[model samples]
Target chain A: MVSLQAAVESAAPVSRLHERASFDPADFPVPGGREEEWRFTPLRRLRRLHADGPLDAGKAGVEADAGPEITVVAAEHGDPRLGTAFVPADRVSARAFASFREATIVTIPGGVAAERPVVIRVRGEDAGQAAAGHVLVEAGANSSAVVVLEHAGSATYADNVEFLVGDGARLDVVSVQDWARDAVHLSHHHAVLGKDATFTHMAVTLGGDLVRLAPSVRYAGPGGNAELRGIYFADSGQHLEHRLFVDHARPDCRSRVTYKGALRGDGAHTVWIGDVVIRPEATGTDTYEANRNLVLTDGARADSVPNLEILTGEVVRAGHASASGRLEDEHLFYLTARGIPVEEARRLIIRGFFAELIGQIAADQVRAKVTAAIEAELDAMARAEGGAR
Target chain B: MSTLEIRGLHVSVAAQAGESREILRGVDLTVTAGQTHAIMGPNGSGKSTLAYSIAGHPKYRVTSGSVTLDGRDVLAMSVDERARAGLFLAMQYPVEVPGVTVSNFLRTAVTAVRGEAPKLREFVREMNGAMAALSIDPSFAQRNLNEGFSGGEKKRHEILQLQMLNPKIAILDETDSGLDIDALKVVSAGINAYRQSPDHGVLLITHYTRILRYVRPDFVHVFVGGRIVAEGGPELADELEASGYERFLAMEGAPA
Candidate 1:
């Protein structure tokens, strides 16, 4: 007979007991394949990021540069606002929280508006090394700013990032994971919005062996607004996942989430989960979330799940939707019926899918870079498939 | 001079559960350069299938027939290949291709058909000229192809593509079906300009002769149950206009 803890610690990948989100690492157990959240993720391919493994701060390289109106510091350890935004919902994020060596803090002065976006670049050096990272960002009252976090290179990385928005502040965060093919990344992003504050989070994932990201939003006061948007592309042998949660804890808050992804080639898989909860006390709340996935090849698979938990019938409105489908045959016929070839039509459709989101990027340079990357990925997909199906 | 010749053309489409139903049973017609042939038929008479079959739509299978464009075997070509071989099909219901703007869609088609991309200035001038002729808004060029477009807009957009492509043979499938009188005039004017090309051949498919008032046909064929049962001069359209297809539907043990 095997004990529950022993069973969870065992090598066999099975389902473990469930627990609510916890900030403490001990509150969570090693994830088996059966856990609701972990079932879609490939455990064996995670490179020990989900189980007990080496997490070295020295092995990871992070470079941070803040704008003139912003202040940045490398703190040794605990900040009272660290876990207030979001508790760890999985073992990997909890382990990252418990094992993070040094934390970076980005701060904006009260009522000071930043003209330029702050930039942070994280690059993993050794492919064999597993690393944990933590970042805390706080926006002062009535201050507005944008933050960009770009990831690249190769490593097994698990990290947590939190955003604390002050009243009447407007903040936009664009987190891009353009990792190497051998890299594995698991991250949790939590943003807490103050009264009348507006927050926008955009996640763009293009490269990784298996990258799982969960971004959640919570209201610290009434009249807060949150917008979450994401775009991802998965090629052969790549697994990319995004999970989002919007918790409307205060009254009269509004939230919107839209995510679009494309998958191509054999073994390419993408999973998107969107959850919105309107608490009973959160009357007059309005929220909508949608996820759309387009599969471009025969072997690629996309899974989209949208859940809405509305406890208050007095709320203004709430809805959620998720859909995943292959390239529409009617769209293809529309193009081929013209003189355009099948391959070119496929390219145009995929480009059109990402054009709307890419247009929302305020930084022209970043927008151009992301567009170039998308075009490159489309070219690669065209080459791999030889022609359109 | 160009010509689209169909000889004993028979087409079938797969029905549910692996059954094949013949839509076109021996359709025979010939369209020559500088000539407009209006094929008038009732509903379910397979007029649209004839146009689609000529464009190499995969849904319509050519069982036993010959469709040749200027002595070239058009039935052997792929859909895009057929379009490149000087064949253009203005669909009855233009498909909505989301994310692809009208400008991009036309540019791609023109490039594929002409084997070279048009000069930017020339392309813009031509597009503006065509849009002006059709009374389409300049902003329509930036909109996605046929998406959320009204029926009249879709028809005008189709003619816009026809004007840009300049194909040898143009098949207009129910181009006048949903157009208001005003839109019908604009679309007919665009087609008339294409007709001015000395080598252009037009095969107009319509259930009503309302469009014939604007774009006159040199020959009219009465199609019923996929075959041309009667052929006559322009007077035939007037005869059909005055007397409906009830005369043809009355024939028993024969194609409707």
Candidate 2:
């Protein structure tokens, strides 16, 4: 039983060994497979990583890239208090108690529109170790921007990211998580929207051994809104899960969550759990959540659950729906009857499934990049099953 | 050389399984190029079923029949293969494919049926020309295929596909069902435009005589109880339209 305070304090690394001491795997606490949240996850996947050793930070590479119409604010160790305020100390302490400590802080100034995307690139060098980072975004009143966070590795790694959005500002955040096949990824993103603010987040997950993404958003002010969209594909012994929580804590707030995933090959499992809550005082709140899963193979499995907990009696609208099924035979028949080959028809349907989320992406470059990545993933899966035509 | 030949065709729905309540009971018909053939039938007379079976719908089981396009056996091929063999069915109810633009769908369908990739600029130019001819707005190209479209719009979309695909044999399954007079004229004009090549054959299925008045059929067949009972010149459509299907029903009962 580790305390949250101890975890935060432990994240404060000694100056001399900043590079080596920053991401040491030995300092984190193990889950021991008993926690309820970790029940469905395979802890052995984490055990295979190096449990007690410093990360090879010297091997880390920095490749800075610019994105479309996004403003990037890079502040390393800008202010520890900023991180403390954005990320609750208790959650920081938990990661710290688990011996994972590394941070990246980003800020967008008020009323500033960056025409190019701000890309935050994080890389890990070790195959069997853990790493964590933090991002804090502040958009001033009447400002808009987009942030592209890319997580990649030349080797296997486990990582986490925390994000925050500020008041009266709109933020479009795109996350591309493509790790090595042997890697395990655990990402935690927490966002808080302020008065009259709007936030749109889209995540594309294409590669990983066992990937779990928990994105939680809270509407803390009136007229605040959040739109969350994600696309995940798993194939050949891959396990991908996305758990989302959207809380409407104030009146006149709205939120929407949509996630779609495709699975192929045996032993592949895709899971989605969307939980939305409208508190008692959060009157005039509107929330809608939907999750759709496509199982491409007979042995593949998809489990989707959309849960809504509404406490307010004056809410305008609140509902959640989930669907898990194979491709529709009628759609396939219609396409094939038009002279499209069966394999091409399947590809088109899969592409169309993800196109819904991709179409909602406001930025053209981001949408194109995500679509290309998804197609590549599908091609790889098709090749693995020897079903590519 | 374009001709659709059906011999001893027996088709049934999948739900009935081996019980086999035949929709096209041993029906034989020949439709050659350079001719318009109208199939007039009453409701539940299996007009659309015959059209679907010829186009290779998965639900329409061909118990013991053979459909040939030109010299190629159509029944032995897949739906897509039959389409590529130059057979087209203008579905009475076109399926809506959300998120797929009509232009993209038509382009893919045309290229697939032709077995070659078409030049993009040329395809667009030709598509625009067809749209204008069909009285369809240019914006319709950007919309999802047949989604949220009015009944007339759906029928126009089917005609647009017909003009673009340009199959050797086109089967129009009640293509004039839901159109107003203006839309019907526009659609008939588009179909007439497709008649430039005598190598193209048309199997027009309709319960009314209005479309036949516009696109004057060269031959007419009266279908009753899942079988064609009588065949005559274009005068037969006028006869059927004037006297209804009672004469055809009596002819069918004559047992010849």
Candidate 3:
């Protein structure tokens, strides 16, 4: 019989387990949809960004805004600071790394706290051509900053984002993928935290035809803390997937992952996978991960999986939970019985389901924008589903 | 003054294998303005069913009966419509709506009932007054509605809504089931304070007469086997408390 340790080890893909990180596109092979990581993704809709497809020469529309305490520069791909945080793990990221002409590097000086966030907006111009881009946000020692990356418009895009947080630093990153319905995007977010550093990353995926985001974290030293939070809404014919990996290679580190999603309409689907591993030598690690999905209408599907693997017995805590379900009947009754109309009650519950997570967002504008987008989505869902009532 | 009249109310709940079982079998009662009606019964005596059926819970279907609030066909109204028409039920077990704060829910409820959103200052003052009367911490208003609340906290929150909504008719379904003596006294005082107005009516359903000792009922009903077997004044409550529900269950042949 295979041992429990072997079984647990086999649950996650070996490719991701000993992740091959390189900036060379030749180091990765094109997936055939049979690989565990690509099994759930629809490859045909990716517009050949996965293989030898030519990447557009022109950069996607890009804009950056930051306070005086930070610097934003578009340097060539050979910039020494470009890939300091992480190497390209998959084919798309490697392709983006190699094909992109220039990469945006945002740097905050050590010990200087930024009053405002470093905001970067990437707007895709065409759905007919595939595009590639890259961004790196670097926080020096004892520095505190917030960085937001907003993606919009319609195009087939692949990119990578690196966050390097220094010792005793604080970094909050909010990446929003609110594209047109015809857009197809794949992204990789890599973060490295130093001693006593704190990092938080929020991914709000609202409008995309097929969006897959992979975010992974690695600690450079002990006393590092990372929180990865995400929210997504999938309408008809849309696919949204978020996969996270938290690698605890150091002692006395902590990680928490929480993601919530809602699906409505036929063929609307969402997938959330949280993988956490505590190395044998990494004792005193505290971690918890959870994913909750709300299926609002017929013909919608959600798949949630949480994989927690521990090689050492000495741990502060380690746990995971995942659930996908419809709204409770009694929840509706409770709301309506309080004089909220049926439609309004359903909306309120859906909003309430997301409020707690959204409230934790540090940036006020992103939070308000996400809330308004959710309200609009709810309005459209009501208009479509209200006929039955 | 409003009147809630239930004439020959029969309610059946959906059960296993597509079959519906009758819970309230021809329950007839009238709760008028300025009166407190106590519905005392055993665990399976269906008194709670009577309360929910009148409140338009979709789970309990009304069959061959009529429930009217001030001559309006309450059975025909939706759950929210009934609430908008000044009907409220303090459930034995309130639902826990995560992320929906007590303050937000109360404001939404008050807005829906009053046909307009109250000004921020006015609403905060009103909520503060009601919460203070219930002895709830000011921070309690910011907590999610009934989420992680204790039994006493949930009951007190129900009464807080009762005060804020200021409904014409209130149905207390086993509100005193899970309360300590001190909480019971506080809840009773809240009910008594709300009942000081002659225009409000109350239908208190419970299994014991412990709460009736504090909030005396104008009418006492002994509910058993889906129907009221006896009705009288406060003396009936004392009699039942002294003798327990044994005699009534024996009379109904409810497998005692």
Candidate 4:
């Protein structure tokens, strides 16, 4: 019963109107604490990383682990492939784009199937210092690969990750933000899918003082498919946010988005924004988005917004849904009345809530690690509350 | 020999517009091992309240009562404690848990009740045998518990648990309400099998006497106006079926 991580599968989406895209840091000025994107964030807690601060990583670094069929290149600024598939939408993304002296470029050879995942480990060694990073992953035509961008340690950091999926390629990227409790990290992910290509992105954010991510996808040709999935847990005094967008500008494209989150303790806050758009020329486009949140204790807040805009009447399907609530008393009672302890019952329900998304993870070690981390969070909450709740 | 003793149980529920309505008023009943007591009543006559109160449902406030099992105060125990104390209630309406599969739920309940986890192979073997006996598909073991299940499936699953948990006393609340003839027979067989064990007792609550034809009760009690009005042997069920509770409804002073 402790390892039922593989059995649960299940959600449905929310949206807020937004229109801001730029590559120049000047074009996107510092958030004055009142903008829609920065309102939920505590500006003072950012440690002035949003201002004219240091961008050199100093001790923070990135390391790649891959097989011989793949190439991990370190290219300097003005690398032609660095920003070809990415556009900085916010000031943090723009600053991260302008500040990095070098970027990590990962290329998977065409028609090559990797036996193991390409793990890009981003680790920080200092908590008081600020840094920015950039990584671009190119999946060659007919290639199949899984890239894991894992973050750990402590630092004030910002980064931009771009994935260019070539024709008939399949690329799945999992970004896990298991940072130190004192770390503040922000990131943006841009993905472009070619004809008949398949792309998937999963975000796992469990540890950090403040973590925000925006992952967007664009279809570059017809018959492309993209799916976005995320699972996150916020502890006491933590902020986690994810903003997602999927654009269908080509005919015969499909997209799906689902994210689930749980928050416990005082001042625990989480947010999800899903925006999907189907344009006029995009005939036969299909899309749906959903977000669900569970608030385990008092003083925690979760905001979910799902928006779907369709300018063409020729599309097949377009829908969205959002739900944010506390645990159901009936579920707890059902489990407890069957002889399960109340604490164990609560743990099961919370784990089941996130199992739907976590079950989709293909890597066994990564899934086990995520499960262990969440279990630790649940244990901490039980100790703090003394199982009374 | 195990026995469940109930004395002077008074239960109430919250009513609309800031008021309280009594559901079980000074009712008393007892069931010893090897006994099946059938309590038949009309609609809204507090039959379910008796079953729920005995199971420690939070909605049923036990204003004044005492329920004990072999000298232990069952009223002092929480819901799970009651189950661990050898009391079970096969609920008429089982709640649907979205992600917990049937097999996982059954194993968890068995472990909690038994106080030790069973071996995986042994558990699966027992589960498969029980499932086959109940005529349930093996694929149902992976489906979520009671989620998107038919009425018959839910009822059969309840009896399956009744057999699996093997509690000392079981209060079956309307287990045959929505069952077809075949399902009713299967579920009744499951219940009968559970009753075969020594130190096991049953309190079957229902509105009709059709199920009595299959699983005969040892005693029949006429329930009306939140209390038992009459008690007799199994023949009383046949008499009540022939002549409905119309005469019993007109008996002594009853509250609306």
Q: Which candidate is the best by TM-score?
A: 3
Cα TM-score per model = 0.95, 0.87, 0.95, 0.94
- Native-to-model Cα distance after best TM-score fit, residue B250 in candidate 4, in Å: 3.1
In angstroms, how far off is A366's CA in candidate 1? 1.9
Q: How well does each candidate reproduce the native contacts, as fnat?
A: 0.62, 0.50, 0.77, 0.52
DockQ of each: 0.67, 0.46, 0.80, 0.66
- The order by descending DockQ is 3, 1, 4, 2
A51-157 per-residue lDDT for model 3 (tens digits): 88888653488889999879999989688888877888789988988888778889999998999988999998887888888898899999999899999998788
The stretch of ten residues in a row with the least summed lDDT in candidate 1 chain A is A10-19
TM-score ranking, best first: 3, 1, 4, 2
**Model 3: DockQ score:** 0.80
lDDT (C-alpha, whole model) for all candidates? 0.87, 0.75, 0.90, 0.87
Clashing pairs in 1: none
Relative to the real complex, the DockQ score for model 1 comes to 0.67
Expressed as tens digits, the lDDT of each residue in B1-256 for candidate 2 is 7889999898888554456566877788998888889999999888999998988777788888788887789888988898888888888888877667888778878888888989999999999999988889999999888889999999998888888888888999999999999999998987888865798888999999999989989989999988889899999988887899987776654554
lDDT of 3 by residue, B1-256 (tens): 8999989888899999999998887778999989999999999989889988878888998888899999999998999999999899999999999888899889998999999999999999989988988999999989999999999999999999999999999999999998999999999999999888999999999998999989989999999999988899999999988999988886574432
Model 1 reaches what TM-score against the true structure?
A: 0.95
DockQ-derived CAPRI band for the predicted complex in model 2: acceptable
At residue A212, give the lDDT of candidate 4: 88
- Give candidate 1's error at residue A325 in angstroms: 1.5
The TM-score that candidate 3 achieves is 0.95
Model 3: residues with Cα > 4 Å off, grouped in runs: A1-18, A387-389, B253-256
Mark the regions of model 1 whose C-alpha exceeds 4 Å error after superposition.
A1-19, A387-389, B251-256
What lDDT, from 0 to 1, does candidate 4 have? 0.87
Best lDDT goes to which candidate? 3
